[model samples]
Target: MIPTVVWGTGNVGRAAIRAVDAHPKLQLAAVLVHQPAKVGRDAGELAGLDRSLGVSATDDVGAVLAAGHRAVVYAASGDVRPDEALADVVRAVRAGAVVVSPALYPLYDHRNAPAEFRDPVRAAVEEGGGSLFASGVDPGWGNDVLPLLVSGLGSVVDGIRCQEIFDYSTYEQEESVRYLVGMGQPMDYVPPMLIESVPTMVWGGQVRMMARALGVELDGIRETLERRPLESTVRTRTMGEFAAGTQGAVRFEVQGIVGGEPRIVIEHVTRIHPSCAPDWPVPPDGSGAHRVIVEGRPRIEVTVEASDEGENRSAGGNATAVGRLVGAIDWLVEAEPGLYDALDVPLRPAVGRLGRNQKEEERA
Candidate 1:
């Protein structure tokens, strides 16, 4: 079994712990949490699992690395501290641990990443003979793998669009939702994520990755954004009140232009309240969905909605993200040391997990 450590206990980290525990080929090593209160706690309890896994949580990064774990699931939040997160990943890679994460955005497409972020990771891989892969839901398989897979069903694909439609009311990140996304803020307040070129900086990699897969060269990339104000005062369970005329919803697209036409696009329609954008696309079943539309002779649209920890779409999305990263650990352990993108990893079936449900049935 591959010895693996989950770093962080937030949204994604919680799912990673449960995933590692359930994986047939992996063994949970030590969980790393920044909060001192979480130290010495059982990994399962930290993950909200009923049973204990015997492994304890620690804040000692040095000791965890020195213990020589085979793989690391770096689930720490990078939205607020991207530089520090990158440094942490570098430290793990240089300690001879193959790492997978969704923290660093620039490195999502390492091939086109800036030299400052790309050079150090390359050097670390060489130094310790380890590998690193960074990916997530929107910028991850939702755009790259899912769309490309659906495109194959079409005889002649003219254009492809990947979309993430969600309501952020249940999303736990308050600062990101209120400030970074401009939700619950005034209409004139510009969210950091929607500023010029910022969308390109984050989701641009998905566009490029799709173009590369389709064997097309993009003439250029472009961004377009739209924000909507709440019609009336709205209150959320966690976040407080969003007064009338405040920013309640946002829609944006990062398009990859090919042959002077926008051939590939990654679009997002996010809202603070479900009622904010009635006309915009929404999940088929619930408040969140990742969708792919292949505009061709026989147009195909696919939607994925996952709910975990009490039907919370945000937690569900994070769980899927953890699934993607943790599932790739075994492959990274066998592959050569280097940096990799979503395309480099193969999506395998749940061969071993198929029987897990049956075993649980017997146990119960």
Candidate 2:
């Protein structure tokens, strides 16, 4: 297996670095970073590992790519800089690196992606002779892989609903929470995430992917949203305070219409405070969870709750997304070069991890 270069040192990038370093087959070749201050830091420090991983972070993208790393975990934040992220992934693939990322939303299900989003990546993959796959928590395994796998357990399937119930207080990205998602915006202000066809553009592909996997034809896609304002001012540990009458909670659904009904759905129930949305769903056992519920026959439901140190729900979700990308490196290396989505990239079996914990114990 070719070593992996982890690009970006954000939430997802940090997880990807740790995942690649700990994997039995993969090695962390380099940590690509944009910040000059992080240029020479050890990979372990960036990823919060106990000891240094020999690889150092670098700002020189080309030099790192040319260093013979066969794969890159492109974990840069896509919410704000999608085009930049896409261009970087394109360059990595063209540089002969198989790329796996959650950055490019359109490529999560490249089959349904618009031409503006899919065409360039397709062409780049064809030219580079390297594979590209994009996925994330909500649009990644939660909706596509988990739901379709659960569908097999049911004798008669009516509707498949995938839900991500999370509290965003610990989520550190301030700009995103305040503006992009409109978490604490005034009630009159429309959150960018729920405005117009944004939800469809972001999540419709997941619905379509699930439908395709279940052999169900979708007639169309629809979206619905609801928001709740804070009864009084409340402060969060990370993103500061929200004044009274501002947006505090939001529930939205991206529905896949089947025979004029919303059959396959990807729904989100998010809040700044746990108390805001009492009626809305919460993770059964923890602060957050990704759940897949089948509405038919036996009525099967599966809930996934992951936790890292400090019980950070956001980190858990980030780790899952990283694993989905890094674990697929072996498969991606052998698959035909092109743009792939979760549907094309099946969930891989657990790669037996060794040598990491023992080292940690020794250091401690």
Candidate 3:
């Protein structure tokens, strides 16, 4: 079994613990934390597992890295702390621990990634003789892998579109929703996520990744946005009441225009309240789903609706991300040491993974 350490204990981090613990190929080495409150806690308890794994959580990242784990699942958020997260991941790789993380967005497709952000990570991999992989649920599989795979099913394809339609009220990340995404904020204020060329900076890589997967050269990337305000006061279980007329929902599209048209596109329809975008596309279950639509000869459309513990779609989606990264540990360890993304490494299915999700299994 590969010795694996999970960093962070938040949404994705907790899921990482569960994934690494359950995987037959991985051993729960240690969990790294940033909060003092989480230190010295049992890994299973922190991950909400059925029993303790006897591995304690520590905030000392250096000691954990120095302990010689084969792989590190870096779940720390890069939304607000990209630089810090980059440095941390580099330190892990330099310590000779193969890294798989969603924190570093720039390395999602390192080949076309900006030199400013990609060079440091590239250098770290070269010096450490370790590998790095960056991905997430949306920008990860929902964008690149799923689109290209769906396109193969159709005989002729004119355009490919990926959509993330969900309600953010259940997702309790206040800073991300309120500030980064501009949810529940005033319309006059421009959210940092949508500022000119920022969407392109974050999601444009996914567009390029998809284009490269489909073997097409894009003309250029483009962005179009729309905002809607809540008509009446609404309340959420996690977040408190949102006043009427504030920013209630946001819909945006980052298109990879080819041949003078938006051929390859990534669209997000997010609403603080489900009713905000009644007319916009939504999950048939009224929760959320990753959709891939191939507009062509077959006009194929596929939607994935998944959930984790007790119908927590947010947790379920993140679990899939954890599963994707953790499942690739052995593959990343044996492969040539370099930076990788979804296209570079295949997500191999674990033989015992099915038994772990037996409840969801029987439902099928």
Clashes of each: 0, 0, 0
Residue 257 displacement in candidate 3 (angstroms): 0.4
lDDT of 1 by residue, 1-364 (tens): 8999999998889999999988878888999999999999999899999998899999999999999999999999888688999999999999999999999888888999999889999999999988999997553889888899999999999999999998999887798899889998999898888889988988898789889999999999999988899999999987889988999999999999998989999999999887897898888764898888999989998888888888888888889878888999999999999999999999888757886543355446
The estimated TM-scores of all candidates read: 0.96, 0.95, 0.96
76-108 in candidate 2: lDDT tens per residue? Answer: 888878889888988888877899998888777
Predicted structure 2: lDDT: 0.84
Score candidate 3 by lDDT. 0.86
Q: Pairing residues by index, what is the TM-score of model 3?
A: 0.96
Task: Indicate the residue-level lDDT of 104 in model 3.
Answer: 76
| Number of backbone clashes in candidate 3 | 0
Model 2, poorest ten-residue lDDT window?
354-363
What's the residue-level lDDT of 336 in candidate 1?
95
Would you list the clashing residue pairs of candidate 2? none
